[model samples]
Target: MASLTIRQLDKSYPLAKGARNLVLNKIDLTLHSNEFVSIVGASGCGKSTLLSIAAGLEEFDSGEVLVDDQPIQGPGIDRGVVFQSYTLLPWLTARQNIEFALKSAGYAHTERAEIAQQHLELVKLAHAADKWPAELSGGMQQRVAIARALSYRPKILLMDEPFGALDAMTRRQMQQLLLEIWETHRLTVMFVTHDIEEAIYLSDRVVVMKPAEIDQCIDIPIERPRDFSVTHHPDFLNIQSQIFERISQPLEHA
Candidate 1:
């Protein structure tokens, strides 16, 4: 099983000359195996930075990040990342896009094509497997991106506001599709989103962040196979209220 562990992680960005702006400060978080966790916070609070660090895309000044007891030195095949933008190569067909990743995962040339097609169908995009990125709609493109990320069988899926650009209905549809894939494969997922209801509905726990640290890690407690209907559940509303309250308040420095 894949599990992510972070302890006392710190990140900062340098400015002009000698000044630096601290973003994530002394952060500690752990995502257990087969767990779904979503992070929510205001902009510029280093939410994305933290995820980038976990993906081994960014450097940390202090602390450690380990996946299944192994330290992450840089980006590895064990982790797959999906960004806010589609990040697909415009010229490549959906199947080709997935094939590109499978190539890096070291699959044989013949094996790559078959694996790519399988993942396309997994994301329900087999019919559009031959379509170019420019030819597909936003939602469909994101589906292709998801298919590509999963094609190599990464142990963890790191998503950074992947559906933030989609329309409401399409976003919901994608969410359901994601849940279906998750249930079937049970890959450890760490999703970052700005939507409170979406976080509550999709995550096993909701991580509330302040500027440089987490304020709370609220457990969702809501039963799985959850649909949009969970949004109206009494406990769901209560959890939403809790998250809203945490975010609305000003950060308290330690």
Candidate 2:
């Protein structure tokens, strides 16, 4: 079943003096259950805007977005979002951050602690459960963010470059961790990123977007249980080259 469906999605922002700036134009996309889909494009291409719309955090100018066939009107527990920034409360520890989400989700008090610790352990940060956001490393902070998002057990996970702020090494580690988590939980994920390799590495299919619409949708033929070593395979290099060439094209508005 399709977990999320977006059709004819057009989004614009009001400009000064009664003008409008179009950001997403007539876009159509669908994410199947347990699928990992990544949207990639240059800056100002509206990839993040698309993600925000999917998360119901932003409204679109026209069109319909559905989760499990029901139209999305606003933020709902059916979806969980993780942005590039580690949006944890500074006063809350790692576990507390997740517990807070659970509490807000109406989970029972006793169950909240158990679910929070389980998710922390899922992200391999159970040992750092008591650490504040400032006390954790960049990658660790993102892990906490992921754990918090998953604590609600949303049907779909929306990530907008959740690893963009980490160092190269840490980013790779997070990628592996994410893959493991996704496999374990069978999540339906829609991730947005500017990094082509990261998109290719983590996605089952890569959706390349231009300024306001999709340019291409390419499937990664690589087998699952993937690791960093797959990057050197011939098929991986070929697919990467094709996506790189597509993204290198000059934008119409540019």
Candidate 3:
């Protein structure tokens, strides 16, 4: 488990022939060990950018990312990232893909296989372990991607729209799967998505981001081991409504 601190985080991109554009501004947030945090916002809200920076995939102009009071210098096993696109190797089977990550991480051959199988089972993809990415459906491919990410045993899982490519039904299944894994592993998770319902259903707290800044954060406060039944609960909609209100707020012109 790891705790995170982001203080005055800022990111900017240089224009083609002019001044740089500020993407993130003075963003400060904390994620406790084993906490599940979800971020939702508008299209250009820098949600993904923030996740990338936190994962050490991208650099920021200012501020710091600290884990367990230590600085995050670059991508490490402590932070695993899963993007919307399933970044699996088509030539490798699901089990093989996960094993490769373990091998690169310096796990012994016997240990690598054991860890790979364990994660595949965790994601309920054991049946498809032998199948190559091309043979798996979109959802199954993502399951393999998830299995690989988990095999590394990262303390924090940074997911950016990981289910955006799935159909509605598959999306629901994936959400439940993710929640189950999260509950079992108790890893710190920071997920970014545009779907309010998804954010509300899976997170301990929803961090709502505006175009250039974080707007508000709402605690879910619902009991854990969540499922589709959560949508029927009155409290669920109350949180959903709260998120909607934040999203619909108008941004003042710069």
Best candidate, lDDT: 2
Q: List the residue pairs that clash in candidate 1.
A: none
Which has the better lDDT: candidate 1, or candidate 3?
A: 1
Supply candidate 3's per-residue lDDT for 140. Answer: 92
Give one digit per residue, the lDDT tens place, for model 2 in 1-254.
23899999999999999999999999999999999999988888999999999999998889999998899989877898999999999999999999999999899998999999999999999999999999999999999999999998999999999999999999999999999999889989999998888999999999998888899999999999999999999999998998888788888543
Q: Candidate 3 on 72-97: residue-level lDDT in tens? A: 98988888889999999888899999
Give the worst 10-residue stretch by lDDT in candidate 2.
245-254
Please estimate how well model 1 matches the true structure, expressed as its whole-model Cα lDDT.
Answer: 0.92
What are the candidates' C-alpha RMSDs? 1.3, 1.3, 1.4
lDDT of 1 by residue, 208-248 (tens): 99898888999999888988888999999999998998898
Q: What is the Cα-based lDDT of residue 12 in candidate 2?
A: 96
What is residue 82's positional error in candidate 3, in angstroms? 0.9
Least accurate stretch of 10 residues (summed lDDT) in model 1?
Answer: 245-254
Judge candidate 1 at residue 250 and give its lDDT. Answer: 65
Error in Å for residue 23 of model 1? 0.7
